[model samples]
Target: MKGRFVTFEGIDGAGKSTHIGWYIERLRARGIDVVQTREPGGSALAEALRELLLAQRMPIETELLLMFAARRDHLERLIRPALAAGQWVICDRFTDSTYAYQGAGRGAPGERIAWLEAWVHGDLQPDRTYLFDLAPQLAAQRRAAVRTPDRFEREDTAFFERVRHGYQDRARADPSRFVVLDGEQAVSTLRVLLEEDIVTLCNT
Candidate 1:
């Protein structure tokens, strides 16, 4: 059987970071062979792009292109291979982030992102995408004390508002593949829901 591809997404501080480890631990305990990776930093080349993407300012088009470039490398070098070998690939973020951050947050055209997705990724899509939904104001407040904000993190509240909207739109359009989870809920509660969902997914 081809392994499952699961990607977790959300705005900067929407509690995804807090729960991912716990989720992965449970997945591993269930005897799933898991490969935990992250976007823009999965492979060596992608990590380089991740650094540039987070530190440099460029045109929205440029930023979006670089993101796809890294993704191509990540998919080819790591993600595809792992899944082909029957190991579940759990990614921290993926193309959805590009749509939210570059397409919506930066005002890049939807057509442009669509074009790139087709050309770069073919028909590949996540088996499941969990969105940790939270308000931008609350998310920003959670991360206020973090040291040395990255480019995306440094963006003002309005930018994140657009990003949050972009993610919500994605969830609405693909309800079957996208799971929208309220980020304000207690981690324990969310974990239970996540585990139940994953159990169902794996059984299927």
Candidate 2:
């Protein structure tokens, strides 16, 4: 049986991590066997790469490559296996990040990134993607309150604005598979929306 793969994506400080647990709990309460993981940091090697990528000083190209490298390891080691075993895999981020961060944010060749994704994982795409939509300035404020900003998070507002648009573009292009959620709302409100989506996904 093919298991469900759901990915959560958005610009940094979009409150995705803050809301992840709510979804996890809702799924487990319904007796679903869920495997929760985050990209660029799922497995040991991937986690190491995540640290390097998030550090304050790394070339943009290096960051992009590291993200992909972690993704390759994450898919082969954890994601695919969990899905094959009929587990619901909920990932924090996935290929979409590469497109937004590298392709749109850092101005990498879009075709090259597309080629890389296909080359690395032929048919491994998320069944559903939930994109938390919010302005970069608001997101930055939220980010500032929680923890120190990472390399990506430290980018100027203009850069983050581009990243937000990148996400929006991806979602718009694939509306059938992507759901945009208003991320500026209260966490309680977001939880309700997520629960609704979860019910629809599981029941279908």
Tens-place lDDT digits, model 1, residues 1-204: 669999999999998778778888988998988999998789999999999999998988788889999999999999999999998999999999988999889999998999999998867899999999999888888898665678899999999999999999999999999999999998889998999998889888
**Against the true structure, whose TM-score is highest?**
1
Q: Rate the local accuracy (lDDT) of all candidates.
A: 0.91, 0.88
- The segments of candidate 2 whose C-alpha lies over 4 angstroms from its true place after superposition are none
lDDT over C-alpha atoms for residue 137 of model 2: 88
Q: Count the backbone clashes (under 3 Å) in each candidate.
A: 0, 0
Over 1-204, each residue of candidate 2 has an lDDT whose tens digit, in order, gives 458999999999998898887788888998899999998789999998888888747676777777888998999899999999999999998999889988899998888888888888878889899999999989989888889877788899999888899999999999988989999888998888888898889877
Candidate 2 matches the true fold with a TM-score of 0.96
TM-score of predicted structure 1: 0.97
